[model samples]
Target: MTRMLERAPNLAILYPRALVKRGGGHELPDTRLGLRDVAVERERLTEYHRVCGFGPSDTLPGTYPQVLAFPLAIALMSERAFPFPLPGIVHIGNTITQRRPIAATERLTFEVRTGNLRPHRRGRQFDVVTEARVGDEPVWDSTATYLRRGAGTGAAAPEPGEVLPTTAVWRVPGNVGRRYARASGDRNPIHLHPLTAKLFGFPRAIAHGMWMKARCLAAIEGRLPEAWTAEVRFAKPLLLPSTVDFGVRGRDFSVASGGRPHLTGRAVPAPGNATPHPG
Candidate 1:
C-alpha cells in the first residue's frame, strides 16, 4: 500500500487535457445524462426516508447526489489515462451546492472536471477543485484537499475563527453502511471490502460520504425551508457499523460517527425564484 501511494501521480495529470486544451482554456464537457432505469432495491430512498427520522413525503434525501456524483467521480477517476492512483488517494473533504432538488425518476447527466490544483503550505499536500453539472445547469461544485504523505512543508496550524451557526442532529444506524453499498452500486472495496479497508488503514469499511450527506438533509427538512443551499465539509471518515448523530441548528448541520465529527456545514434556504422541489 505504501508503495502504491508513493507511485501515485499528481491529480494534475488526471485533467482531461484534450478537453482542457480546447478553446485555449479548460472547458467542461457538455452534460452527460444518466438514465434511472436501474431499480433501487437495497439502498432505496425509502430506507433513508425512515432513517432520517422524518415522516413520509418529505423531500428526497440530500445525499441523493451520491446516486450520480459518486458514480461520475468513480468513472473519471478510473479512466486509465487519468493520472491519479485510485487506491492511493483519500477523500479528505467535499462541498456540495444543490441548485435544484433531485427527483427519483429524473434523467440526469453529470458534467465533471478536475479543477485548480494548488500546493498547500504543507509540502506534499494539495487541493483539487471538482464540479458537476446536470444538463446545462450547474448543480454541485466541491473542492477536495489531499495530503501526499511525503510532500508536506510541516507548517503550524492556522488560527481558528468565530464559531459558525450550528446545525441539527440525527442518529445514523450501524447497519446502513452495507445497505448504502448494496443500493448505490458503489460496492467499492474500501467501503464494503473489510480486507481492503484494513489494507488501507481503516478499521472497517466506512459509510459512503453521500449516505451521511443524505442523513443531514433528512435532519433539516422543513427546518430549512424550500430552495435552501447547503454546503458540507467532511472532517473525518465515518467507519462501518457505527452510528452517527446529525442535525441542523441555526444555519449549521452536522454528522458525527464514533464520537468523532464526520461532516459539518451551513445551509441557506433556497431563494424564491430557484427550482422547486420535485416529487
Candidate 2:
C-alpha cells in the first residue's frame, strides 16, 4: 500500500513523532509514502548552494533532491511500524543517480520506502530509498544505507587503503553544521553545537555526511556530466573547526583530517541515458 500526499509533511512535527515511536520489529512497513507537486523555492535553493559551496547554476545540484525528499524519509522512518529506532540509527553510505539535470523551476514529486534489511558487522543495516520525478518521468533517485549498532557478526573490520594525494586543503568552520542544517533541514544533534554533540558521545560537533557529499560534488562540478551518479561511504566523524585535505583522482575523490579519511566517493557519467528507478 502507498499513501500519497499533495504537500510535504512538516519536519518540526515529524521529529517528535520519531522520538516517541519505538521500533523493534523484524519486518519493515509494507506501505510507501509519496508527495506530489512539491515546489522549489529559489531563495532556499540559493542558500543551500552557498552553504554547500556550489556555484550558481540554472539546474539543481545532484544532492538537492535528497533535501527535498528528506522530510518524507523521516516520516517513513518515524512510523511505529518501522523496525529501527530513529534516535541512534547511523547513516553509513549513500548513492545518488541523476537521469538528467533537473531545472530549479521544475515541480517535483517524491516517493520514499525502505527495504534490504540485513545483518552487518556491527549490527543490522537497511536502505531508505527515495526518488524524485517531474510528472511521470524519474529524474533523480538515492539509496541511503543506515546501521543500527548492536550484537556483531564478529567479522574483522576492513583495512584502510593507501591515502590519496592531496590537491587542496580546506578549513571547515565550527558553524558549518548549523549552516547546512538551516539549508537542508537535517539538524541531527551530533552535527550541532559541541554541547549537544557531547550528549551523543562525540567530543565535539561533527559534519553532516550529505553536506560532505555536496561539497565534494561542488569541488568537481565542472567535470560532471549532464546525467550521472555519485556515491559515498562515510567513515570517521569529521570534528568541527578542523583543516582537512581534499584529493581527487580521475572521477574519484576523498576527504581526510588528521591523516584519517572521513569520506570516500566517486562520480561518473550515467550509462546510455537509461531511465532511473522510480523507487
Index of the highest-lDDT prediction: 2
> What tens digits encode model 2's per-residue C-alpha lDDT throughout 156-253?
54333335689999899999999999998888778989999998799999999999999999999999887889888888889998899999988799
When summed lDDT is taken over every stretch of 10 residues in candidate 1, the lowest stretch is 1-10
* Candidate 1 C-alpha lDDT tens digits along 1-279: 001111222223433232233122223222232322222333366665664344555334455544544545544444444444455555555555555555554434444445444344443333344443444555444455544343656564232122333343334455566676655556656676567778778888777776666666666666765455666666667776655565456767666644556777677865433553252
- The candidate maximizing TM-score is 2
- The C-alpha lDDT values of all candidates are 0.51, 0.86
Stretches of model 1 off by over 4 angstroms after superposition: 1-43, 47-55, 121-150, 154-173, 243-247, 257-260, 270-279
Evaluated at residue 240, the lDDT of candidate 1 is 68
TM-scores for all candidates: the values are: 0.67, 0.93
Error of 2 at 180 (Å): 0.5
Model 2, position 181, has a per-residue lDDT of: 92
